[model samples]
Target: MISATTILTFIGMATATYCSRILGYLLLANRVLSPRARAVMDVAPGCVLISVIAPHFVSSRPEEIAALAITLLAASRLSMFPTVVIAMTSLGVLKSVFN
Candidate 1:
């Protein structure tokens, strides 16, 4: 059973994430961005993704570390959809094999 505290925490996180995404659009809605600023915007999502997944790099598990390596390799050589597919498939296989 989920505790009330856990549910509230999830709600708070969702609200915060939603508000931040919306706030960015609102702030930039009328402004014309420079080429440099546009490049930053293009890479922002990838940076956020790396920040979220970076903790996995410090994990002691062999399968997780291996999976992260595989993810990095795929990300370098493939498009986003293929990279995601390869990462998820590799992680699932590695977890099953290791466990």
Candidate 2:
């Protein structure tokens, strides 16, 4: 079994990654990034998502991927609070059932 600490670390890292995106936008409005760096940033999100999600999908079982896909789809239309509620509940249920 994956230790809770390992799971927590992964969640923490993902959260930090998301927080850094908001920080980048906030800092960008106040200051400027280099043109070269800005160009890279513009094309980064798709690459980053594919890189992260690809292996996650590969490693996860079908039910895990199904829940993740549903979360991703719903997140487009859902508010942050509801999204969090749904995601947490779904993950808790799925993990409990599977593991």
Candidate 3:
């Protein structure tokens, strides 16, 4: 069973993530950004994604490495929702096959 602590942790993490994503938009809502600044903002999420997944590149497990490659490819070629779906599906399959 999930403990109360675990559930609260999940909630806290969710809130933090949501706030981080929205905070920048809120702060800049009244300002006009230059083209360069807009471009940087657009790619900020990808940078966050890279930071989260970069450590997995050093993983010794073949499944994890393969899944990361698949995720990178999907992220490059597809939208965020489809990329997440493909990444999750590929990781699940790769883990089962490798194990």
- Top model number, TM-score: 3
lDDT of each: 0.70, 0.61, 0.72
Give per-residue CA lDDT, model 1, range 1-99, as digits (tens). Answer: 335674565355445445555676788889999999878765654565466558889999998899899989998998655765576667678877987
Q: What pairs collide in candidate 3?
A: none
User: Which has the better TM-score: candidate 1, or candidate 2?
Assistant: 1
Error of 1 at 83 (Å): 1.6
The order by descending lDDT is 3, 1, 2
Best by lDDT: 3
> lDDT by residue for model 3 over 1-99, one digit each (tens)?
335674565355445445655887998899999999988877765565566568889999998899999999998899755775676678668877887
Please provide, for model 2 over 2-93, each residue's C-alpha lDDT reduced to its tens digit, 9 standing for 90 to 100. Answer: 46884675466456556656766877877678999888765554344445445546654865686677667766887544654565557567
Mark the regions of model 2 whose C-alpha exceeds 4 Å error after superposition: 1-3, 32-51, 79-85
Model 1 alpha-carbon miss at residue 15, Å: 15
Between candidates 2 and 3, which one is better according to lDDT? 3
lDDT of 3: 0.72
